[model samples]
Target: MQGYILQIQKIKDEDCIVYILTNSSLVKSYRFYGARHSKITQGYKLDFELEHSMTFLPRLVNTMHLGHRWLINRDKLFLWQQFIRLFYEHLKELNDVEEIYFNVLEECALKLDKQNAKRLFIEAYAKILDAEGRLHNCDFCFLCDYEIGDKVALARGFLPSHEHCMNQNGFDKDEIEEFFKTKKSLNLSDETVNRLYNILLDGF
Candidate 1:
């Protein structure tokens, strides 16, 4: 199956725990280190086989790295690392992560670049929230439950609130509403995009 390497934990000499995000689930597979073993690292999209065992962790076998051209650029590589780290952190508690989640990561990996990484990251995150039914879908403040006027501050998980109530600066409520509806942030400024991304960093 095709998957992205989310994390790698070194164990004893040459052995490690590999946490990979497959299309439908998050899997922890054991890697027996050897020169002939497949080269793998975080943020790598790989095609590999897993040998399941009742007595131990699944074995990662016959791995082939895929679509690694993006890593040739250090800037894009850094962005990809940050993106995958977010996934690794957010999905740690879950056994079966959704396919949509994997797709979001894949989409970002396929489209991310030095110039548009931030925008694409924000867009992908917005799509993820929408897929999980967590995207805020109200015209009122999530905190005070009051109708929001022109300006609305967004909290972690994109929870909306009146600017005064949240004590945070934010974008126009109507534009944010449009962003929610269309899943596009093209018109948003770099500063606004950074604010939105910061909210995501506060967690899923």
Candidate 2:
């Protein structure tokens, strides 16, 4: 199967535990390091085979790195690694995850070099929430269960609350509402994108 290496944990003697995000699931595989084996880096896409082992995790072998033009750009690559790391945290505990998670990463990766990383990150995260049926209508304040005012403080998953309720500055009601509906960060300022990105880091 083809997958993106989300994270690699080094074990004894350079062996490692690799967490991969594939089309249908998050899979963990073990790699036995050897001089003949190519090093695997996080964020690299690979076409690989899994060798089932009786005493260990599935063995990763015969790997071929899928070439993406963005890989050569260090700045873009760093952003990709940082943004993709969030998926490991968000999905690590889940047993059943929708295929949209992988699709979101694939779509975002294809556009990373063409668009602002913060904007792409926000949009991709919103897509994840939408697919999970957690992206709610941001009309009422989740805290008070009342209709919100001109400002809304969005929690980790864009759960809207009145600014007074959250005791923090809120986003403009109309703008945030549009963002929720469209899942597009193009209309939002970079500052707003950064805020949403930080909230995304909190979790899925």
Candidate 3:
């Protein structure tokens, strides 16, 4: 199916919960604004139906209601839809948090020869992972083979994920390709970059 623009807000808390906020009025009015006989009551009913029936809508709601701090924004819904399609459907990529945390540290470490940068990277990973565990309230971590606890960072849209699962999935590859393609090229450690490269070699 063709993707449509959607106005979306992606909220992230220290505790890894991502919330999506949107202006529902615009969503409902998009198609029926010029429909014959469209009235106030009909608009309400249509809004109710569209919000309720769409599978992705509920996920956004749950994120907002549950998370302590929510990320909020108003943007074109088409861009949101495009992001979802690219990350979830086409490449099965991971989220922004993971990319930033790992990429930034890796870049700092290699280009500047900074061990502290690597330390910060690992630290950030732990912090975010802890937040993910706490928010989801599950100890079982997918990235770590052992059920270290009850939390597994279920791959949500626009969030970071554990390093291992990021590799097992295609997120790492997308990160590398996208990173190199960007003008501000990344400085990834040889081992870390090679690991990602090997995964890409294996393919999905």
Q: What is the TM-score of each candidate against the true structure?
A: 0.92, 0.93, 0.19
Name model 3 segments beyond 4 Å from true.
Answer: 1-4, 7-26, 30-81, 84-139, 142-146, 149-204
- How much RMSD separates candidate 2 from the native structure? 1.5
Tally clashing residue pairs in candidate 3: 15
Give per-residue CA lDDT, model 3, range 1-204, as digits (tens).
011222223233211112211221123112222234222211011112222444333211111111111112123222223322222232223322333333332232233322332233333333333444522322334445444222122343223344455543433434333432332225555555434333222211
The TM-score between candidate 1 and the true structure equals 0.92
Worst 10 residues of 3 by lDDT: 62-71
In the range 68-165, model 1's lDDT, one tens digit per residue, is 56688888788778878888998977789788988888777777643487778888888988888889965889888888888888887788888889
Candidate structures ordered by lDDT, highest first? 2, 1, 3
* Strongest candidate by lDDT: 2
What is candidate 3's local distance difference test score?
A: 0.29
Comparison by lDDT, 2 against 3, better one: 2
Q: Any runs in candidate 1 off by more than 4 Å, and if so which? A: 113-115
Clashing pairs in 2: none
**What C-alpha lDDT do the candidate models reach, one value each?**
0.84, 0.85, 0.29
